[model samples]
Target: MHSNRRINVDPAKIHCYIRELDRSLLRLAKSSTSIKSLTFIDSELKRVEQCIVRAARESGNLVASRFGGILEISSKGSKTGKDLVTDVDRASQNLIANIMSETCPGHVLLGEEDPPDKKQEASDWMWIVDPIDGTTNYVNSSNIYAISIAALYKGETVAAAIWIPWPNDDGFELMHARKGHGTWIGDSKLHVHPENETGVPATGILSSFPRWMPKAFNINKQLMENQGEIRNGGSACYEQFMVAKGSMQYAITGVASTWDFAAGILLINEAGGKVMRLNSDGLFENFNGWAENYKPDPQTYERLRKWRGLILSGPPRTVDFVAANLSLKQPRLFTRIKMLFNN
Candidate 1:
């Protein structure tokens, strides 16, 4: 009778156990990339995606809990004191790192808050994280902040997840994707807007203006006058995620790093949009390759820590149009003097 008696189970505990099982399967899949086993690959991708969702949720919750409260503000860069790092940022990163470690043991962790201290090995299977993609926005009490995570296997991104801290309820907004699988927000899949059939070109674009890259201001102004409108949300992840979701025609910025745009790059690709970096010849080339087979030596890695140039993302035609219209040549001394006098 003791053995035959029915036993009650906590549904929450069962859910947690299932989540663990998914994470384990995902780790197995990530470890066996060379085999190209479709079954394992698919299953593992799903699992990595699950881990991403879980991490994003937990991190977002922590952010929400601390919102509107007094935060410990700090700085990272020396001399300039331009870049800001807050206690919330560190706490959020720590939360994500801890959660990911619990889910996938032995997987390498690389985060913006705490980057890899030692040389990055070629075989490193990495989870790249940006605990708060829009730190300034969060500090200013804006809703554009988000948590981003991506899984890199041999330098290729196989899965990514980003969570927007919004509504202050219902678990926030989420966007995610896998290499072959489509991108999605909540339960709905995302797609780039169809090309305008009426023949009139898209008038507006989304863009960024880093304080360090003021030279691009002239071109950005030109885009605003020629195009219908220009917008800067102060959040790199939000801009790219919006592009992938068809809310923006394209995104332009002076420069970006892996953590700033890695997750959203996959989203745009999987959503049938394009991402490119301008070349010296004034032609657009796929910068997506930067995320693949990336084993840079310390010097090279430091150099690539932040790249400078035109970064654009959108439908092919729109991106090409913007690239061609914007003048790539830096203003001559005379031109700069004339502009300053005119202003």
Candidate 2:
């Protein structure tokens, strides 16, 4: 039986644990007749990655098949019509969840559309998924949508895959990464633009600050005014992939959930870039810890369901620049007093 106890693992130790687990699994695979000798942990992870990509690819095809047909769209408690959920989204998520269940049994599935059970603890193995990232774009036939999936073992992102349905004039694109194994798009390795070469005047940024979030208003405004160009692709994963490919300097979002940024964070980090939190303080705290120690409880899931706040990511220099410039909007006098008294 799975434990109901909540646990938090240090992010730093996750890679070590995965390595040890890989070694043990390798030995077991060699001995077990049912397990092929090549089915080591790394290969197993890659297999899962491929499975996710396949599911996402098929989902894209489903969307393509329905294009110009009818997309049964609806809102998921968002006041704005831009925040949408569609039949394709649910279908894609269901497909991913089922594949994970069949391929990697016992793993926890935490998806944007289908979260794990509230009674369980954060499992040692957690698969984070965003079935259709750019729902708004997808619904409108913008071709900027993507399916994002990531494997989190004890809080560290072990493997991630972001499948872009229509990457360019060519065809679909798959960006994926495994811990300690560089990020890749198709067969080419991805690298962040060098600090010296990435200047703000020429750099493009993908930013989104929900109109309801007051804290990000001034900061986001400044970003729009100062950055060379600010683009909102409506899909967080795709924007992060653009950053990873050196096409964009940074992707900043004020209201991001785990599924929205999980795969993207790993992608940028593995591509020699940095993902940093942005708030009133300019301090660079570790943002990966929360996911590393996630608890699958109602309270934790409730918090994860809400917007967590702002994230700035890209080349180190670009991240630092944005962090330094962005500051929370100050509360009014009465609001400040109320907040202070409440605190």
Candidate 3:
């Protein structure tokens, strides 16, 4: 039987624990030297990248095959009842999980749909997956949905793969990256557009912001005035893919979970871009990495699942420019008092 007891491994000792694991399969350096550790990590990440790319491709095909078919959909029990899950989403995740079990067995698998019950399985590495990222778009027969898969080592994303549908039913495009390796689409490496002389896009650039944020904040207007144009492709992963390829300048998402951006964050970072998130100070701060406060316990999955925040990602200069121009609306007196009391 799988134990429910928490395994409290100190974050600082995680590397030591990893070194003691099956070294032949993991290829982790047994040495304490930082150089050797980094080298081993890179080598392992390369293997992880290959595994996830295959998983993403298979899941993508599964999603595409059911794109227009009748799907059994249900609400995720959100307040608005708009958040949805479908049969295809569960099937896609199952397929990805099966592939991971074969290629990288014993690693923890976390998916947007039904996470694993064995929290003790989360050892040194965990796979974060979003089998169908744009579920609403997929439900509506839109081609903007994507499959995202990423591997996190000691809470830091080390490898990622995102599969997006190609236009005209031309199969899918797989964008993948490993830490210290450049992001790639097929054989070509991706580089974000260079900062223009004005520290912005030369002409209007394709960009995205949450459609509903305009009602509560002026971020939409600020983006339009400073960034020139705006568009929301209904899929955060798709928008992030565009940014990684230099086709879009930036994208700002309202309240997103880890699975929504895990793969894209690494993709953008590897493509010479940056990601920022709205902090408690009401400022957009650079997102350095994930799992900074991770606890290796049964509750860790819940902590990650509950993780939600606003995100802005793009080329560093453009991201800074947009962050500078954006501001939140001041709360009303009652709202401020309520917030203070709640805090």
Candidate 4:
């Protein structure tokens, strides 16, 4: 009879308990802040860093617990019908939002699962979250997924954390960074491999849409032959983590949303890497200048929600070399017509 019995559990209560624990820890840490020399902005960023780290950890646990189990999956109605959203994704985002609400009240939340109107309220602080960065990977039982959380103050990403599953262990590791503080996995500060600067062959990640594959094939081929091994891990955040940790020399993604790469951008930048994006002029340009010119407003949040672009990131030298060799110019009208006819 005991073997046939089922145990009932309340996920809501458990989530509440976790939120309370996070709040208590935040309070305790704040009380111990004896340094009076820190600027107000710096102090706020430090607190946000602590909160985001805990939020990522808790959200990662939620995602890990559901892996390989029965998942309620749906599509985001994309043209390819391949953009998936699982129940775990919703649960993870909700858990993160709950924690942020309790710990950092009044901050605007820009989450993957939230509607655009949610950002209509203008606020100085914004939390950008991709609860499950690799939902498709998670659904397929791959461990390449990640939880990404970032805090933006005045339209600048100041504190960020990414929770990635450990390959050999059954646990997760959180990689976090503050704006001026170097990226960290625990106490060790992360720095991109200096070998990347020497242009030695090294592993790199490359991704593009299926339609663009033909055009990108030459670049991919050249990279493999001259730059080293080429891979696509399907998760932008995971690829960014690898680059930040010096495991990979660079990563280029043809399609990425703000939430998909916000935290990863900060992590890579903090790790002494560089990031560039494709511009309308058919060239890759430095991407770090946005924060310098950003003007915070409700409309800015709206624009961020709709933002999508090609991003290339890595050590400064490697990124420049890769960008210089890449040919992303759009096809001419005649060329497009000829390709359609050939197809």
Candidate 5:
């Protein structure tokens, strides 16, 4: 983690959490329902967060052993070339779902590795679970990987968590967000950093493992040369978690999935940063949305417009400056989205 803010647990954590909840509700009034439902959502989320950490870490280590081995993988859609679903993915997602159901029977579960069951999609409150955010990484043991979970109510992410098993020089991170109560890393709650900007103060991107990609290749070369530091240990959930803590300026993954970033997008946003599509050039910003659709329409566009391959970062001026220097392409929706984003 690139952050200097150390965690010191006080009895006040609960009091502060409650006070913030009240204030957030008072401010929301009738504008949003996120306040009204967060209490129930937050409780269930805490349960999920606690139980998933060890399981997710174990799953990552379990999946990493057969490195460079042929994958027992298959494609999801008959016609789609890259939409793969694997045996490890199925087993892992099922493991998370089953554990969650046993631990939190009332909550719902939705995952990327399998077809949605009516039981999950129909529930009032649902948990979006990406058993393994980086499945390809699992196939090759290219990078360790992550498990992301976000609890949603009425299609808005009231609470979200991203867990990465292993951390680089930065240790493993756990990021949780509860509506307007703000974000947290382990026990330390985070605030909107009015001063810190992404990719500065330290290198923007933090890879859990260094050389996961390009072990010395082009993307790696450009990132190290331009971004400042490179680490690639394992796990997107932890990487994004560190960024939310301001331990890392940005968390980058060459390839990401709906589950990989869906919860992360919501998590970082709650922490006051943003996640956007990496280098997409589309008329509509890729919401990277799921069946959960746990965000407002505006939130989707904002996420994509802000993304540079799921960069968990903040400070618009700094992002633009970095994107420009990297020669990243602006989206077709960039012009329309700019007025809404720029003050």
Candidate 6:
């Protein structure tokens, strides 16, 4: 019975396991990369994916504990207004980190919810994870939630998987990717929908502003003028999946956490798309400096360590075009505190 059980969630540790998968895929693709046993790689990638789902399930359990069992939550303030952080996030991080370290001791782990204390840069083998990407949705019980995990052997995102436990009834959907190996959601290969007229179509092209950025408050205004459409699904993991799976052109917003976008971005990139700072607008299209820029509240750093908003995903031309237009008079206000204080 246990052997046939289908897993339904994603976990941080999956990033660690992907390192193993990438290694195996490298050899498999080479044909002669290895002359010995081959079943090992096949079995192992499956196992690695299982590890991701398992870890995500554990993370989900920890979150459920907070929602139903614990009320000891605190606010991260207006930046992440109504978003609450709990001991559960820390507890889950610790659990996932320990397991990953033990399994792939050589892999450097960078998590979204809990980043490394030491500021050393990510190296050849790094596991990037967002134990829970949509904390706000998780806390509000409004859906839009997931665990994101990715493997980056160097700065390049190598392989990734996003497992959502609930889709229709908060159930599950699994997406997987490996650099140069193509992307998959379940048994299907993935591709971003090419843009229509602009040659790119981003689903979240004009999602409502974060309620904080005054610069782009008129996103709807501009969308109407440009004759384009925008869509919002809820979670970064989901948005990225849609982009990779070719349902939407791309997804873009602001203020992304490394973990929140890690797995999804990797999936998009490995699938032959792009993700970069909205300011650059290089990933999808080109920036035109049309919309005023917006900065995430500095307090967001304290609320969640690794963040700068997320541009979920989409076709390169389409996304780049939007990013090119969005400009902020006060971009990253928090980072410029020293300059402000000096004045």
| Cα lDDT, all candidates | 0.70, 0.69, 0.80, 0.78, 0.55, 0.57
lDDT of 2 by residue, 191-247 (tens): 976666433434443443344434433455544465656667777788887888777
Index of the highest-TM-score prediction: 3
Alpha-carbon TM-score of each model against the true structure: 0.75, 0.74, 0.82, 0.79, 0.54, 0.63
Q: Candidate 1: minimum summed lDDT over ten consecutive residues — where?
A: 334-343
User: Per-residue alpha-carbon lDDT of model 5 for 6-89, expressed as tens digits?
Assistant: 888777988999999999888788556666576666676566556655455554555444445666887676765466667777
Runs of candidate 4 exceeding 4 Å displacement: 1-38, 78-81, 116-119, 168-170, 196-200, 203-224, 289-296, 333-343
Weakest ten-residue segment in model 2 by summed lDDT? 334-343
Clashing pairs in 4: none
Give the residue spans of candidate 3 off by over 4 A: 1-36, 78-81, 115-121, 168-170, 219-224, 332-343
TM-score of 1: 0.75
Count clashing residue pairs in model 5: 17
What is the lDDT for 94 in model 3? 96
Error of 5 at 122 (Å): 4.1
Question: Where is the poorest 10-residue window by lDDT in model 3?
Answer: 334-343
Candidate 6 yields a Cα-based lDDT of 0.57
Residue 62 CA error for candidate 6 (Å)? 5.1
* Shift of residue 292 alpha carbon in model 2, Å: 5.3
- Give lDDT tens digits, candidate 6, residues 1-343: 3577778756667877898899998877787645334556545445555566566656666665565454445665666466566566667777777766766666666675443454544445666777666666766665566767776544445567776655455456667766556777667777766665664333444332233444432333444455235555556776676667776565664455556666777677756676655433222232211112212333322323433443535567656655555554544553442222110
lDDT of 1 by residue, 23-116 (tens): 9999988877646787777898798889988898888889878877899877677744356778988898898888778887766666778643
Rank order by TM-score, top first? 3, 4, 1, 2, 6, 5
Point to the candidate with the largest lDDT: 3
